[model samples]
Target: MDAFNLAKQRYADLGVDVEKSLQTLAATPVSLQCWQGDDVGGFENAGGALTGGIAATGNYPGKARGPAELRADLDLALSLIPGSHRVNVHASYAELGGQKVDRDAYTIEHFAGWVDWAKQRGLGLDFNPTCFSHPLSADGFTLSHHDEAVRKFWIRHGIACRKIAGEMGRRLGKTVITNFWMPDGFKDTPVNRRAYRERMEQSLDEIFAVAIDQQCNRDALESKLFGVGFESCTIGSHEFYMGYTMKNKKVLCLDAGHFHPTETLADKISSVLQFLPEILLHVSRGVRWDSDHVVALDDQTRALMEEIVRGDYLSRVHIGMDFFDASINRIMAWVIGARNTQKALLLALIEPRDRLRKLEAEGDYSTRLALLEEAKSLPFGAIWDEFCRRNNTPVGVAWIPTVKDYEKKVLSARK
Candidate 1:
């Protein structure tokens, strides 16, 4: 209590409200991706390898084999992390009843259990249409496939997934964001690129043709530069999605790891918000390509959150995780990634924005640079430690032993 008071007074001296920051942080929700639990292997029982430029590297023991186990693992993770949050589900993670069902024919009934689970836990939900690792998308193209049959198949899948998202929001009494990301591209440079993009434009129009109330479900389209097999060209490039979003007044998803090596999502947040009403961010780390490495409290991560806070776009920018690393304990991976995201946001919230903004506006570059560098060494760790105590989460590295115990008592029993 004494240390926390000192830190609070220190922040107060800088004209930053630490209590307000914690309150705002508590209200903000980070959607945790479910794919990390099972390494993108959903409950369809599709005994096939992941295709379309997506791959999970490790063969970690005790991977969630079904919906129930996955939910339990998520519960453990949620317990360790502070603040309210949501779960991001892929269409592939449906609760099929041992009966074979295709992605296109999916319905809200398949996800009833998930809704109940989330509702019980007082958590919000987000969804994505899984368009890869299936027969129709075997050729590395889905929404932009050259074949009419393949294109329509993916279109139906998108439409169905949107409706499911609507139902989730309707029942939970909160708007659910259904994001669309397809691995539609070419392994080699195609003779004609416009043809594929044209098909994609038409397919997206058809999928969004049915009027679903925005209050129930909001639509977001994601773009990518390249994937494992589709290195030559990606149909849904950032330019394409930005244009579509502006015209349609829908959310444009900017994935952290989906862009070129040199580009960062931080610099694009304000620019995108200028044109679009809202934006969704898939927070992941890319080593060289879109590797989906677990996120850390790095400089890039801090910059991303700082941009959001400084721009006052917290409400407009939705934050969600999109990485999957099977090398570590999956539960700990979720905790680490989620905590780091929250930490970054906390650090951003604690910044003396008014002072910096005034300096920038008045052209006091020297003082601004000095203060910015000085802030890096502030007592942020003390506030973060107090935040964990307030939220009843484990402080610092204390949560690690809990995860290891769970691995021994639960995960190890799976095999």
Candidate 2:
């Protein structure tokens, strides 16, 4: 069949109305993690650690020069990707001697400025704390560390930035979202490991306290219109995993690829969801034991994808493509990654659940297991085609399509 007619027939078979599916897809917002001047040669001068012994210099090409240039680039990128507004800013500096030392000031002011700028453009900000600057945080930012002064400094800086973000939201009529990921683990036996976890929580408490204060301040100013949204992620092995702390917070931003090299992705997702039903997912692809390549999903990663679809957390979910690619055009990488992730998520939502049910009824784990395997290996193009085709109707596009569509086609159809 021709591509268009094949698409049409697929829609008919899935009992989906085309127009409604498009609307549904359009409604799903795809957020991105972008550097300030990733395009227009601006990333060249930002000044940071070199990767793989290569000096980090002006690698990106575009019109951006400084902060304003970077901000403009982000604005343009968001414009091209519809329903995408959130940008994760990577704040880093090598030294406090010159312009690099003043990065704290620049970062604070630039982010606050961007928050204002994003308001004008109707976008959101996702601020990630300092991680790239290894010299400053060589010992990591855990509470158990002996660097009391440095730890205090980190807390003060975080509070200051968040306060500025909160104030900007009040003035600009937008929301400021924050995500915290602490590098606080050890490879060897720690002298005082328990002390470290406690300290980390203590630091987090201080940060959370500031957030609560900022939320109140924002709430009081605008009648609770522009409140702060707090999220945190950690490597899966943290002493007190993110889900444990997220109970008091709004949501945990689960990094699907951050679990240990040998850990099962699906088990991690199931565990986190069981603990915290509402989550903000950070999607990236990598082997269980290798570096983050930022490639699309493989078989192992799909296990988590399946749980995300079958669970009840899709609506509250916000998707972000988190990866590093210095050689490729940064904006294009983001755009392509976002598009591919959209396809993956939609496929997970549409996979036939009746097959899963039959496998359960017959105590046949193999078919259900194979279904997840198949779901993961399905090509991105095929997934998007199927999603668009199956979601072609208003009824097919109803509330929480995954759950509802599963009920209509699989559950009701069986009856």
Candidate 3:
């Protein structure tokens, strides 16, 4: 407490309100990805390999096999994470009865169990339309496929997901962000990229034809540079989605791992906010490509959050986790990625943005640079520790042993 108090005074001298930063961070919610627990394997009972750009590379034992087990594991992860939070669910993760239910035909009844589970924990929910890992999408063309039947199949699935998301949000009294990302492209350079993008645009329009209230469900469109097999041409490229999102006034999801290796989203947030009302961010780490590695407190992430806070666009941005690392303890992976995300946001929030901006506006570049470098040495760890302590979550390494104990008792016993 004494250390935190001293750190608070130091930041206060720079015109940064430490209490306001903590309050704002506590109110912010970071959405957790559910696929990290079971390596993108959902409860659909669909015995098929993960196709599309998705692949969780690890044979870690004690993976959750069903909804009950997955929820139990999530419960433990959320307990360790500080601040308000929500869970992001892919359509494939729906908890349905033993009977087979196709994706296009799915309804909210299939996910009522998930809503009830979230309600019990006072956690909000976000959703995704799973457009991969099914026979319909096995050809690596869905929504953008030339075949009308194939395109319509994925189109219906997307529409159904929007309806489900609306209901989930209505029940929870929070807007559920339904994001659409498809693995539709060609392995080799296609002669007709226009046709595929045209089909995709049409499909998206039809899926969003039904007007769900923005308060009930918000929509996001995600784009990718390339994927595993479709390295030559990705139909839904960044330019395509950016143009579409601007025209339609929908949220554009800028995933950290979805761009070129050298590019960072910190440079794009303010650019998009100029036209789009709001945007969604999928925080992930990419190794050369979109490998979906666990997120860390790296420079790219810190810069991204700094842009959001410095631009005062935090309220206009919805942040969600998109990485899935199956190589380590899944529960621990969740805690590490989520906590680091919170840490990055806190680091950005604690910056003396007003003073920095004043210096920059006054043409005092040298002093701005000096202050920025000096601020990097500030006691951010103390503020973070105090945040965790106030949230009643385990501070630092204290939560790690709980995960190990859960693995030994609950996870190991799984056959």
What are the clash counts of all predictions, listed in order?
A: 0, 16, 0
The residue-by-residue lDDT of candidate 1 on 1-415, one tens digit each, is 7888898898889899999999999999999999999999988864468988899998788889788899999999999999989999999888888878899999999999999999999989999999899989888999888789989999999999999999999999888999988888988889999998999999999999988889989999999999998999999999999999899888999999999989978999999999888999988999988999999999889999999999999999899999999888899899999999999999999999999999999999999999999889889989999889989999999999999999999999986
Off by over 4 Å in 2: 1-5, 15-21, 36-45, 50-65, 79-83, 91-109, 131-138, 141-143, 168-175, 185-188, 211-236, 243-247, 287-290, 300-302, 354-415
lDDT of 2 at 263: 56
Cα lDDT of model 2 by residue, 122-234, tens digit: 66555555432344455444333468876676676556556655655565554545555555444444566566666766765675575434432221100000101101322
Q: Please list the residue runs of candidate 3 whose C-alpha ends up more than 4 Å from where it truly belongs after superposition.
A: none
For model 2, how big is the CA root-mean-square deviation? 12.2
What is the C-alpha lDDT profile of model 3 across 1-415, one tens digit per residue?
9999999999999999999999999999999999999999998854458999778898878889888899999999999999999999999998768877899999998999889999998999999999999988998999999899998899899989999999999999989999999999889889999989999999999998988988989999999999999999999999999999998888999999999998868999999999999999999999888988888999988998999999999999999999988789999999999999999999999999999999999999999999999999999889999999999999879999999999999989976
TM-score, candidate 3, is 0.99
- Give residue 138's lDDT in candidate 2 (0 to 100): 55
Residue 131 deviation, candidate 2, in Å? 4.7
